[model samples]
Target: MNKDQQPVVLGKIGASHGVNGWMKITTYTDSVTGIFDYSPWLLNERGQWREVKVLRWRQQGKGVIASLESVDSREQAQILTNCEIGVLQESMQNLPEGDFYWRDLIGCEVTNTNGYNMGKVDQILETGSNDVLMVKANVKDAFGKRERMIPLVMEQFIKNVDLLEKQILVDWDPDF
Candidate 1:
């Protein structure tokens, strides 16, 4: 898929691990090694996208180190530092029932039980207790508040998430 079509960011290339072209990776997946599930990663370099194959990889201390096929030196690995590694949306595995990826929640409109439009999800933050949804206020709800942070607690706060409709129904107080 093209760069614009790529959906999920699996990981990012961090500092070079060693002189032999291995680069430290900071993954956004559930597990550190889960990033390796998809091959032929698309690296976002500047504004262009380049495909790179993972020659080999292994888990390190809480993270992962990988060697790309063409990257065979410390200097080569350095050039890829801070580059985002992503795969096409179709490459992701299907989730089980009641589970959802963070990417799927972003940009979805959030409304209250009374059918009042609250805002659109701008980002999702992971807290010690639970996940928080940061919703950017819409024109209708832009009453001095610019954003809202709602807890993603199923049945408690989050009533329903309709990804197909690009909306999330919540049990929130718009005044709060």
Candidate 2:
């Protein structure tokens, strides 16, 4: 698939591990090893996405180290440092009921029970307690404020998530 068609970023390459082209990877998934499930990662390079094959990988401490084809030297692996690793959207695994990927939630409009449009989801942040949704405040509410942080506490603050409608119904206070 094309670069524009690339799916969610699963991980990012870190510093070089050793002299054998091994590089450390920080994954965004629940499990670091989960990233390996998606083969043929797309590496963002100079504004363009290039496909890279994962020759082998292993879990190290809390992160993972991998060897990618064509990268045979420590210098070559260093070139991939901080590069985003992604897969085609279609290659992602199917989720069960009540489960949603962060990619699907972003860009969805957020509204309250009283029909107050909070904003659109700009991004999601992970906290030790729970995940928070950073909603980019709409023009109507952009009076000095840029965004609002809403906790993703299901059935409490989040009422419903309608992917088809590209909206999230919440029960948050408008004043806050």
Candidate 3:
């Protein structure tokens, strides 16, 4: 995928199922059955793009079993095991009102209450109940510099997010 393209991490291959070319897919969506709706799934293996059509899909106990259009043997399915499926970001639906995808929030500049520059948000952790923003703060020590993570909660932190400017204003203390 191009660097300019928005990543649309669709699903990932979990393990090989039975003796056929079926694969257990752990999808990022709520409904695994809906994965078939998006045809021509893009698989990323060893940093290469491979397009495969969804032949069929069915719900298993906890995950879903998907069979590709051309893959017909266990060996063929093994090649796709652990492969991450994704597409360009433009293919996804637009985010609604207050909702924002993780990709959108990442790379936004973060600042503290006293206008102290924290850093940029590298990623967000979905910690079951609430999400935590991992801010890549460049901390300078004696030797050189390093990065740190600041938890973004509704307490005395993360006041606002200006999507237009791609920035996050927080109410936090720089010294822990």
Candidate 4:
């Protein structure tokens, strides 16, 4: 989850399509066609890795229905319900400069202008407009810890992102 690292998440599996091995997928990407490009995709079945082939697929409603090569029954497809799909680190395309995939920003460190370490990014939460960074912060006094969510806005609060150092320099204040 380093800032320099790249990972392509194929999104979560939806309901089974038909009696065949085809299943629906809820994609977060702009185009469902992106998923069909990869021949063999890595499926996360409750965090375990399972390789599945995308024999045929099309976008339907808010998701995509894909026919897996070996999946022949609804019951078999049903087993993949809610499974998360991800590509290997080597499968992603090279991004343009200043453009980063969400997976790359998940574990970068966030520091304020005054050198106060805010937190390390735990995950990225997708909103309709933009994505938010979920930061896991350490509590100095309390025994319990807390997480803070900050918006990834451009030129407003974010100052710089040094991927080589795995750090993000923000203009946010600790009081906020």
| Clash count of each predicted structure | 0, 0, 0, 1
lDDT of each: 0.89, 0.90, 0.76, 0.76
Q: TM-score winner between 1 and 2, please give it.
A: 2
Best by TM-score: 2
1-176: candidate 3 lDDT, tens digit per residue: 56566457878998888778998998876466656656568888897777778888899997799888888988889988999988666567676886666777889988777877777888887676677888777565322324445665655566787887998888766665
Model 2: lDDT equals 0.90
* Candidate 1 residue-wise lDDT, 1-176, digit = tens: 65358546888999999899999999988788999998769898996778889999998888889999989899999999999998888788889987899989999999999998888999999897998999999866645668999999999999999989999999999877
Tens digits of per-residue lDDT for model 4, 47-126? 56767788788878766798877789999999889888777777767788887777777789988788878888899887
The per-prediction CA RMSD against the true structure, in angstroms, equals 1.6, 1.7, 3.3, 4.2
Q: Write the per-residue lDDT of candidate 2 for residues 56-149, one digit (tens) a residue.
A: 9998998889999999999999988999998888889999987899999999999999998888999999998999999999877834457889
- Residue pairs in candidate 2 whose N, alpha carbon or C atoms collide under 3 angstroms: none
Off by over 4 Å in 4: 1-8, 45-48, 141-145
Which pairs clash in the backbone of model 1? none
Measured by TM-score, how close is model 2 to the native structure? 0.93
- In candidate 3, how many Å is residue 59 off? 2.4
